[model samples]
Target chain A: MTARFAVGDRVRVDDRTPPGHIRTPWYIRGKSGVVADMVGAFADPEDSARGGDGLPERPLYRVRFRQTVAWPDYAGDGRDTVDIEIFEHWLEPESG
Target chain B: MSTNVDDHDHDHARTFVPDEEDSLGQYAIVEMAVRELLIEKGVFSADEFRQGLEVFDKAGPHLGARAVARAWTDPAYKESLLSDGSAAVKEFGVDMNLTELYVVENTPRVHNVIVCTLCSCYPKPLLGAPPDWYKSRNYRSRMVREPRAVLAEFGTTLPDGVEVRVHDSTATMRYMVLPMRPEGTADLTREQLEALVNRDAMIGVTVVPAP
Candidate 1:
């Protein structure tokens, strides 16, 4: 599945947690960010491990999250941002 | 290239261990299969794998310490470090040709920490393989969000008035913390100073010169 979010689009990572192995680091799971760039599609290793071969490759997105949103009291320069590369399966569209 | 059939089988048989399917058995199985297949196809000789494993085995904990020591002693280098980290590393005689080296500095106001949210992107050339805890989801998730909290859990508690900055490692890049050296070690030699910078200090969970 191709991720809907693209570079410069404001989005929030869904907070839902699922059982089993995941690649999304726990630190940025529920944090929001703007999509930076899309890494080419690749096999979802987590899904492929679960007998999901023939599974279509999914596009990966590089999401850039502001440091403040990830940390409540982050007292840095306030312009600090971190870019995270997440698989398509890990993200969903943010609702207004 | 000695392509003797008997020698080829002998080399494979020596490296292949039974799959216990427990602990690191899966990794071992995969490693053995890949190595054996590659060797059989002459992608790389058995000697290459042997030499690689030897080099890895020879790696010690002192590599990271040596880098830290050089940074502490050189002021111009430190400035270069703060400006362009990877380039400054070249001044120390450390070759980071294979991987990207990220230098995170620790200041009085803010402490720089590093975590690989995905897998361990360790500076194998300098710091060697990462500790198992580094790959744990618990470390990746809690460290960035609640750095102080996570540090405390790891038996590291900073005093009041210090800020924590966590750098999440993604892609092929690796990170190392340039910790603030403790006082009273001024008279020590470079080797002595190197001993003070621990792996935990580089990880930013603990301060240097563990006293």
Candidate 2:
């Protein structure tokens, strides 16, 4: 399947906190970042955790966020960044 | 040789043969029973399990060191490694088919660090099991929040000008840091460079020391 988001596309992580195992970390929820790379498609880890077939794989992207933007109290250099591999379902196009 | 024989005799004299009844916990018993049931049901043979264990036993950080050393010596290999890490490692005969591998390079301007905040998902095929600190709740929680402080605890103090990029291995992708080759090592052979790469350096906990 083709990737929904291409590299350099600005996307925001969905803020919903659904129950069960999730790949997106709490710190990145609702944060916006540009897609660094499309890491290809894979089984949905959230479904796999519950013993499901995890079929119809979803594309995963490495989202890069500035450290200062992720954490208000980040003490490191402003240029520092954090990259998290997030499934396509957890991301949404950033709105103007 | 005489001392070895005496030690063997001393071990044989110990009569503390503990059976199932003498065990303090039932976890091992349950594990063995489940394993036997699985084997009997043809899920996997006992021999296959033993072979898997042997493969795991043979994998360690030394394999990752070899990959790093090769990348340092070969510019073309380093480019391929940075682009397709999983495939590049195959040149060194390391197979990591379970998950996609990404090689993040460390330069003079940027230093890379890796962590699994959700769980202890590591590049076991290349670097063996994750170190105790890598799997600890403290490291998982604090690394992304305060990386400089956490790295300092590991005795890695980066310069203020260097940008620290922390990669969280949250999905099926695993990361390995291709640390910068130390100074005064240009004359060293690949084998010599391999000796300098350690488990912590690949994990980004510490930098490779100059030889």
Q: TM-score, B chain, candidate 2?
A: 0.87
lDDT of 2 by residue, B17-110 (tens): 4444666567887888999999999999999999888878878999889989999999998999899999998876778877978999999999
TM-score of every candidate: 0.64, 0.91
- Candidate-wise lDDT, in order: 0.72, 0.91
Per-residue lDDT of model 1, residues B103-182, tens digit only: 76887877777887667777776676778888888986666666766778778776666666666665434678889988
Per-residue error at A39 for model 2, in Å?
0.8
Q: Which ten residues in a row have the lowest lDDT in candidate 1 chain B?
A: B91-100
Cα error, residue B24 of model 1, in Å, equals 8.5
Q: What fraction of correct interface contacts does each candidate retain?
A: 0.20, 0.98
How is the predicted docking of candidate 2 categorized under the CAPRI scheme?
Answer: high
DockQ, Cα level, model 1 = 0.16
